[model samples]
Target: MAHQASNIPWNVLASNLHWSELKHPGHGDLHLRFKPDQGKKLHYFVEAFIRNIREHSYTARKQYPEHYNPPLPEEVILDDAVVCKITPTVRRWRAQRKHPGFCRCGSGILRSEETEHKCECPIPIPPEERTAAAFYRRYEPNRCYMFFETNGKAFYNLEIVKTLLLYGEMDTIFRVCAYPGVDLRTWWSMYQCYCENPDAGWDSLCRTALLPYIALNVISCFPETWDSASGKTNEKDYRRMRIYQYMLKHCTKSGMTTEVATHPHRQFFGIADGQFKRYGTEFRGPGLHIPYPYGLMPLEAFLNWDQVVESKPAPADIPQVQWILHSKGLPMELVLEIMAFAGYAPRGRLQVPHDPFHPENREELAKYLRFCWEVLVRCDMMAVALGMAIPWRDLVSNTLVQLLSCVPRRWYTIPDDVDHPESYVFL
Candidate 1:
């Protein structure tokens, strides 16, 4: 005997049989189990989490010595109170003729309000008992809308907000929450540059300095994309290539690679200024424009541009490197050695440094690696090292508390000039 398949549509199946609502079969109604107010539960949990952080902060400041100050309760702000809004994804309204309405006393049938019944059912339904009618009357579903603003408004969905809070950037999160007027995009861009080129400190410095200025200066040069009204387009790749070409000509003082230099935009000739001349015909004469890449410099480039651009210290050499490693609760000595020898800077470089065994290398790379291997791994022995819980995860909370306790409030000082309309930075 052959069986026939059900003629259910995919959209109907998706809506009615949502996996999130159907936790277990034959237990309870799926709709009741996952109500629209579920997001409030998450909001409450985050509130409690912040309370705990505040308590911890207070205790750490009290117990520790001088210069130890926790992040003030006012400084940390996370607003999870999302509004319910009508979403674009709408479906047809359900028919309401099949009524499940019952009397309040559970002893009689409830008809329309005007209709007289044989049973002693009340003429009007109580406000509390009218929920079913209100819920079912709505034609379309509601969606939770989440967003937050900074100096220049930064918006995020549920996943991005949760990820930042749960794993990374607790300080950044709090700082932004507290100071909505601070421009966070530049700081984030700098962080990205750091992640991109961990080993080539000078290269990243130059790139970070130059990119923002270029972004501000050439806002109108890029092509349009997905949403013209919103002014958001997928053009970072095009901008990055343009910046790379500019760097080759001015910063590196080398001819551009064949693939980039010969691209359509490179030879677009125009009248421009020479590098040094400030006066006379040579300064503003008609010539092929070579965008002087060295014009932009990152705020932290303290030494002479020529001196610091090429000979910048590696990340491992920076004093703050240890703080970053410790913040993640990683085995620092081992990780640093591994990082230097293997050239594996997370999000920066892929390979380790070459001179691990050099006598002058006082960083103690090998021994640290051995300690980490034994503490974090070494699964051959049934016995767990460190605590029963994971080492990094266990230490991370304490590390964050420690770091936040000492951090000075600086986000408020960021100038509003970065948020100027001409920059055209879309987060």
Candidate 2:
């Protein structure tokens, strides 16, 4: 005998289902149920709910910018107090899930629903944890708690605000909470805190907030999707590259000379006038005369127009290498090493010294000597042994003496044109 195929229950078959209120109160009351069969199909439902809540909250805040207040108590400072309370609650909730009874047959069936309800519930500091001392401490005058009362309104969603506070770090909270359409006042407050405190971890937060937004505005000209030979590039990636290129072009146009961002000591010897003043043998005694140009020459040459133009991809085509090298503050030796590894030779020949006694020749040699000094300064002896594996000390010393004689005297002295009555002439 032929058998009929059994129909699957709609609720059981669907991945996600939502039930709304019943329309009628009688025996045959109508109910609205929405179910999504595929997981991806539920994306719209989730997105719509999130968007609706966000829009409603934003609109409400806008309607009454000054009067619309957060749900924080007047006595509590949202930043400190909320974080203290919410952190323990989240931890307890997590711990409860790990409890043996939480997953047993009776409670397990309803566990997920209960957990969801708990997440949506108002968070409070447990009575046991809230001692008289703690309360008194929280209410202490002229503390960070006072600012929380005035600033609590900046955080619109209580749940998100509570979650952020539970993280303990103020900068982390700001990053997760402050996105596009978030209140600028809240962002500004966090930004000021970062500026004042100057923590390294907050750098990621600052970059996310400032750079991407600026890039988006500038890259709106391009289509949302762009095809490349390898694959399609997303809008965000395309915008980032465009911003990088724009910055490179701007730096080039402005004639901004690249300096070692890390080693300011190296920069002290790069410019013609600055070089002689800092390291000239005439300015200091013989014992004070260090052989090297204090380690700055290679970086300076790499930054020069001649080297940048020569190292182009197509013999004349200016690539972004110059900008990259400059911005990263990578040393010339390292740059050359990278180029050699990549099968490219830096174009310019190291100009050979003709007359060793000539001032110009000595200057050129000094520049080379400075490069060696910089290498040593950047890496220790062991690192040099492991990496470069060369004897640099002898070479560095030899170059130093040759360059010292050429250090300009005028660089160390006051200008001849200056009319100072207090000036004393040294005969």
Candidate 3:
């Protein structure tokens, strides 16, 4: 009868029994399953199970904040249990799931692990205590760990200590220690003694601080290369020392040796001193010029130019000439002419005959030259090269529409008007 009632298509019984059965697998199954009509009850049972699991996990994390400590290793134990719970279900479903380890709800069960007899309940730890323990581990006393100990004290203080060690200046070290606000006085005194008598204490202080101080420029002193017994300097050390001397000399220099003249309109466009004589506008070199009447080109038209040029037939071995044209907002014909002057070709069949005198294919060459002007104006390269900062989008759109308009009327074929005269429009 219990089993028969469980199978009935209803809600009330489904919620009371089947939901509890799903949560505690160890608890005897209610010998119940949900029918289509009992979906609402089944949903309630699932929701309750999820809510209970989340609450339990949160409670665990709140309990064990110092979970990674050696003796307890609470973090490791909790992690293992979580793996057991989540991994089996994930594998069974053939789906990937991120493991949610430890309860974080402040219930303090973070340190608990289940035993054969029973599961250990959550125990909470104070947040402040955990933070102090972590800090101690990072900044503990060690020669190699200077970065943490110094903790960004003023650069001058660090440099003073570094300089003293490099020059064997023991008395100066003692004098500096007499001043206020310096921590670690014992270590400083020990280091000073080591400098005066090399054999007095362990050589650790000199080894730890000496080389790094020199490398960081805290010590102006340089190491001597001569070996006392051999009476000759080590060649390699001599070479490296000389390099540093050269660097110091150059670092003191004041200004540039020569000045180069540039075009007023373009930042990067400049003529060398010699070339300035021929092209100089006023006294400062050639004026930066834009091929297009306007300042920019359309991005779409630029892309079209790139595609069309790439598609044109050319010799297999010879490199192809590439160009771009742009118009800020002017007629495309003007932009095309500027491109031709700049050495680029415009799209469409060429009217001029191939000039044998020219090394390039004259027809293709003309198109390439026009193309270059198109790219400069359209891409706003002229502005960029000359160091003029202009908005990129407006430049691209204006240039593209202008270039499209410049296409020769003959190049665009209108569909036959016999079929639909209204549909065809000439540019």
Candidate 4:
């Protein structure tokens, strides 16, 4: 007995040790068995020990409120006591039938059907805590872990996301990916529920956040040489981008349809109808409803009705960049287009996972060219090519300043004889 006790692993004898040790992967091995009669006894002991520790932790958190160090079974005597309590009593219970109406949480069985109980069992150790290092152990180095808790809440947890991105079933991934909230677990649960019943309505807000993440993820499929037009093209990037575009389009349409159908129509203001009609006859027509677009497309691809009208509209007819002025609700598409045009290809798909933004689309390409020119003028990059700075503040619309930031620089004045190829790259 003494030799067997001495041979027991340090991890099996303690709890407050490193969590890695407490959750030692080999703890389930039967090779560590002590006695033939005690078959699987150690496994039962460890589980019961853990359950007790969690219960104690909950009691401390609730009762002490202000100050409570979670109980530890690190002490040798405590481990001995826990081990002793589990083997005979817990093992005997296992031999007999499980108590009927036992709360699956491992809490005591329900007292009676009429009696109410809150089932004060502890919350599962959050994935952020349970599997902090699991991602590094399992995934490629380039994979980004962006779901860490900010403030007290996490929109997504690493484990569930890893599973969804790398190994989840196709249908499940699609369903969960469309969930609206930040919580991955909730997204997963809602996804399961949605799968079980397809008639339920979707939550539109999910698309607003999910699209960008999907786009960023697809970027990982791009290779190191992805940005260069010359080197070997990564077929994987192209395929993934195409898939992302299709999914995003489908998701946008589905979400939009649901939103439109459920949205409550506004009642016409009867009292003000006569006064409103004096200013415009358009008020007398059917209730005005602007159809929402599928998704925010690439900047250049986005339609500008005022600019595209059959009669060439004046430049001043376009809508002002009020979002920039307000410094709120900035469009993700605009930022993505800026990055694309600026030649700043993101590192891996994980860095900028979201829907595909096509530069090749005629409208997008035209916009890209215009923005490229605007960027050159605003940054004074053209001055380097011209050999002199041209002040055209009046000619350039002042509102353009609101959309693009200008950083003043004199580097363009480098002497013609300067031979540094590296320094001229930015110019």
Candidate 5:
């Protein structure tokens, strides 16, 4: 077992886990396992967990009061053609039982095992979080990034995000990513329920389990918890983080305490304090969402979009930078146009992550942009960039800031109706 702090309720989770072997590329025959077996203890724990959170969130919603510039859609709309196709796939998946739960065979072996006998239980494969680290994507040195994905997680099997914290710099910070088991369209409809009633969150059963797990997972990674367990007031107004901090420290018996009266910023963090070399790929930039030209190409792409559309899959032996450019990458011209709009003159200083003026000011900026969007939409035409938008020059000195602030979040990347991971990537 990994060493854990005395205050942490590690056993709350440990009792639920069972181990299985995996094959890793760097280190062979490692272990990964599914979550709890169907037991009454887990049932009661999850119940009490949801009750505490529902009370807390209901109170917080009244006090904080979220500000949505534009409200959530009345409900998700699905096309009949897509409904015909996806309904069967979802049914087939459910019938086969493609969830992350652990189910044992009567033969005292696992169902996922490649044995000659195939008599097994409902679950086909376990969630991806516990899988042995194989096919690792290299991140840039000293940067913390998530690698493990607990995909296909839902109300039954809660999603857990795992970040692979690298040596030196990355040890000082952490980040987690999760793409839920619910498909895109289903997510919107279910998300609407959470919006309507905070007491019932985006599947409160999963969320109640998730909050305690985040603190447990982060603390377990850092070896010297006594010295390295650092914390701060979450000064930024990410509303989601506000609930996270409050629930972890006050509601859950995780042993974290907050001194201040204000609950928004009361959060804890752990920074690793040792030197370690874990196997992973070298850094590439974040896997970005790409736009296809399909007639809605941006004004900046000009002639290149036309030519690329004609003879795509451009190069034979493409370099790393150009690998998917012919297929999914935004044209080099579009990249330059935005940088030019931002006034990035001939390799001037670039914005670093955690630059206070950008993401940190997102809420205030969102409010200001909402005001701007309200003004523009009065005339009935809005800017046509229908997905993700990153603005560069706050510069009154720049040419475009005079005209536009941002592309609104509601200009959704609404697909023609299908289910795949990145279809709603823009949000």
Candidate 6:
């Protein structure tokens, strides 16, 4: 969702849901493969170790930096031979969970305990086409925890490690499996300024740039019930926690909210900075504090700070415009023309198609719609389109199921720095 595709084939890339190879501004090119959270459980542990780094959680680091020096690279991961040697328990897990058969009522809605399952929605989606989980199953069909690889060796991994209940609904907690050997802290520190010295540190960044999309690819398939995404880190890592909070919100459709939690701590704001090295005299700390609501779009459009603020409601305020512009990477004029054809006014709310793949859309802006769809597929933002057309079953065909991703309940924003300790960022 964040990089420029210098040599990426948008059309072909959209067609494949399993794996992707894209050139990141900081990481050059990386090959990413998606696996369910079942098989390769040890590899999942490796990623968890890296991500947690300190204060070991079942899904994160083992100890604080002062007490624990992370293990060496050799100690972290097993090569293909060592990994393949161990028998995967995926089959056993899958075997244990029986497919809840479709009810005779014919509603696509899934129910458990045949006699007790209820069907409220009368939509007739085929068994395989049921939920977002089923949509992802089309790709990973086998349950796995996904990881990144280059040169046939594992680079890193990410997975939906747990489901949390928050704001009266379910939130999915995911991690970008970090390891001590790879140095994700290095990647985070230099990410914002890298384009200027981009090529020099590509390898050392551990391909962290591809992480956003890799995350988008995996979380996109979680069941609809897993609404928002949640994260937890110590007070020191709050900035990383906040940045991830925003990234997940921007990449997913509207209605998805994010909350990063930490133990109680008082806010200590001092200095801050804006995009492109614009320093903030307020002096808080440094990493990426460029308060631009949109992740990586052209900043020229938002010179007026009066219009936008860094708050909880900020990220999803407009939704499509910034992400579309960044992901498509099209010339400003071409983007304007496409938007004009689509009946969107300058700086107005971008129109969400009533039916994304509907024929009526093809009759008018045929080539332009095609380009927009390509952008959606490349950025894995099809949920933006599918979300607007809520009753996905009412649409023309079930074929669009393969293009599915996760749906968050509503929206996300940054927690107040004064109140939430997790919102504390550092330099």
Cα miss at 349, model 1 (Å)? 2.5
lDDT tens digits by residue: candidate 6, 296-390: 22222222222232221211233467457857888777776775565343221112221111233333223332222222222111122112111
RMSD of each: 32.5, 33.0, 39.5, 32.0, 26.6, 26.1
Clashes of 2: 2
List per-prediction Cα lDDT, in the order shown. 0.24, 0.27, 0.25, 0.24, 0.24, 0.23
Best by TM-score: 5
Name the top lDDT candidate: 2
Q: Which stretches of candidate 5 lie over 4 Å from their true place?
A: 1-11, 14-41, 61-427
- Whichever of 3 and 4 has more TM-score, that candidate is 4
Give the per-residue lDDT digits (tens) of candidate 5, residues 1-427: 2222233333443344322112212111111122345233333433343344334334433432232122122321222333343332222222222223322344423221111123244433332312312111122112121111222233221111101110001111110011111221122113212223322111222222233333334323322221223321122211112122222222222111111111111111110101001111132223523222111222223112322212111122223334344246678776556544543321101121111123343343333223222222211110111111111111111111111112212312435663532222111
lDDT tens per residue, model 3, 1-427: 1111222222342232221223322221122333554434533432332243334334433433322222221212222333343332222111111112212343322111110111222322223212212112211232532422332222112322332232223323333333333343222222222223221111222222212212112111122222224322333122123222221111111111111101110111111112212111221214524222110122222222212213222232112232233325546677656645654432222222111112233444334323322222221221222233333222222221222222213212235653432222222
Tens digits of per-residue lDDT for model 1 on 58-149? Answer: 44334323232233434323322211111100000001111123223333332222111223333222233222122111111112211011
By TM-score, the candidates rank as 5, 2, 6, 4, 1, 3
Instruction: Report lDDT (Cα) of residue 310, candidate 1.
Output: 23
TM-score of 1: 0.16
Q: Report the poorest 10 consecutive residues by lDDT, candidate 4.
A: 264-273
Native-vs-model 2 lDDT?
Answer: 0.27
| Residue-pair clash count for candidate 4 | 15
- Candidate 2 lDDT by residue in tens digits, 267-300: 2222211121212232133344533322212222
Tell me the deviation in Å of residue 70 in model 5: 19
Question: How many steric clashes between backbone atoms does each model show?
Answer: 15, 2, 54, 15, 6, 30
Candidate with more favorable, higher TM-score: 5 or 6: 5
Residue 387 miss distance in model 5 (angstroms): 34
Name the regions of candidate 6 deviating beyond 4 angstroms: 1-209, 221-243, 246-427
Candidate order by decreasing lDDT: 2, 3, 4, 1, 5, 6
